[model samples]
Target: MISILFAVLTALSNGTASVLQRRAAADAPEEDALRLSLLRDLLRKGIWIGGIAMSAVAAVCQAVALATGPIAIVQPIFVIELPFTLLLGGLLFHGSFPRSVWLAVAAVAGGLSLFLLAAAPSGGDASVTTGFWPEALLVTGLFLAALLAVGLRVRGNARAATLGLAAACGYALTAATMKDAMARLDHGVGAFFTGWQLYATAAIGAGSLFVLQNALQAGSLAASQPMLSIGDALISTCYGVTLFSESLRTGWWLVPQLAALALVLAGCIGLSRSPLADGLAPRPDDRPRTDVPAAV
Candidate 1:
């Protein structure tokens, strides 16, 4: 229960952090795509600073959650962060939350709970074997490099989704490495720092921040968010199983797991189409357009 509570708190903080940062990013000066220069202007924004603070809180909650529960349990719960973002956006922007949006939120919430309960994931070793490090690094690095290449060539929504996938890869790997580092703390406080996992976590986490900023800057949240949520959940599940030796129920329970996936997919799709998703979209009156041809 403690772990579950912390996971929920983490989702809330993360969701809010995402919204705040993206809002600030929208107003920041334009820079070359995917360049470090983009963050320079945002550093001056109070909202962005608040967002970073919230992310710090989320990280603390995430560590506690991973320490107490399986990754399968903690990561899937994060899927709800999108819905939480919508809810917070409504409050912050004084916007309406439609019935369909609420329904999608309910679907996500129910599906996540059902999947976790049915899957009953368990059994993970705290410490990883040294031999696995090279293999893990090689595989994850190749995958991320490929994804990033595809993302950088695209424009608009496609670019957002692709970059978001890259970000998801970075974040999932960070979580896996962080879990291993946490496990090392059992030996002694020094053991945590002595391991390469801690260093790897920081590196990957920083990269994820850059990827996520670029994704948000490239286009609407609608385009990037679904890919971010779903990709993270999928990749994190694989990581939990392969890296930590976590197990999920098999056989007949596969039905519920599949059903849960469907529900999550549907909910994400619906939420992505919601008016709330376009909170950042320019209103017709807000910006005069010279791009569109004048009516006869």
Candidate 2:
């Protein structure tokens, strides 16, 4: 229960950070996309700095959650970040919530609930062996490289989605490494600082943030957010199972699990199409002048 609570807090913090960061990223010059210059530009924006602070909070909460529970359970809970982002965005930008927004929120929340109940992931090792790190890192690196290449070749929404998936992969690896590093605390603070996993987590997490910024700059939030939210949950689950030996019900339980996943996918898609989610709805200032006479 403690882990679950922390995970929920992580999701909420991440959602707020995404909204603020995306707002800042949207104003960056196109030439800065996918470059260190993007970060330099973002640093000038107070909103981006605020977002970074929220991300720091999320990171701490995530570390606590991973230490206290299986990664499979903790990571999947982040899917709620999607609804939280959209809802928060709506409130912050538009100051109104549409009916569809509420419905999409319900769908995401309900589907995630159903999936967790069906999967019931549990009983993972607190730490991974050093021997497994090489293979896991190699595979993850290659996959991220491929996605980055694809993202560079694309434009608009395609670029956003591709980079979003790459960021998701990076984040999953970060969580896995963070869990491994946190487990080292069981030894001693000295041991924790000595563990290579701690440094690796910081490096990977920084790279993920860079990719996520490029994703936000590439196109609309609707294009990137679904991939980010869903991809993270699924990829982290794989890492949990393979790296930490976490267990989930198989056999007949797979049926409900798949169904639940479908529900999540559908919900994500529906939310992505929402006007509020994409910032397509007209704000008070954006509304056209109604008092003007027809020129015809």
For residues 173-272, write the lDDT of model 1, one tens digit per residue: 8888888889898999998889888998888898898899888888887788778877887898888888888999999999999898888888888888
The 10 consecutive residues of candidate 2 with the worst lDDT sum are: 280-289
TM-score, model 1 to reference: 0.93
Give the Cα lDDT of each candidate. Answer: 0.83, 0.90
| lDDT, model 1, position 17 | 89
lDDT of 1 at 111: 86
Residue range 58-161, candidate 2, lDDT tens digits:
99999999999999999999999998898888777774577876777888888899889989999989999789989999999899999999999999999999
Per-prediction TM-score: 0.93, 0.94
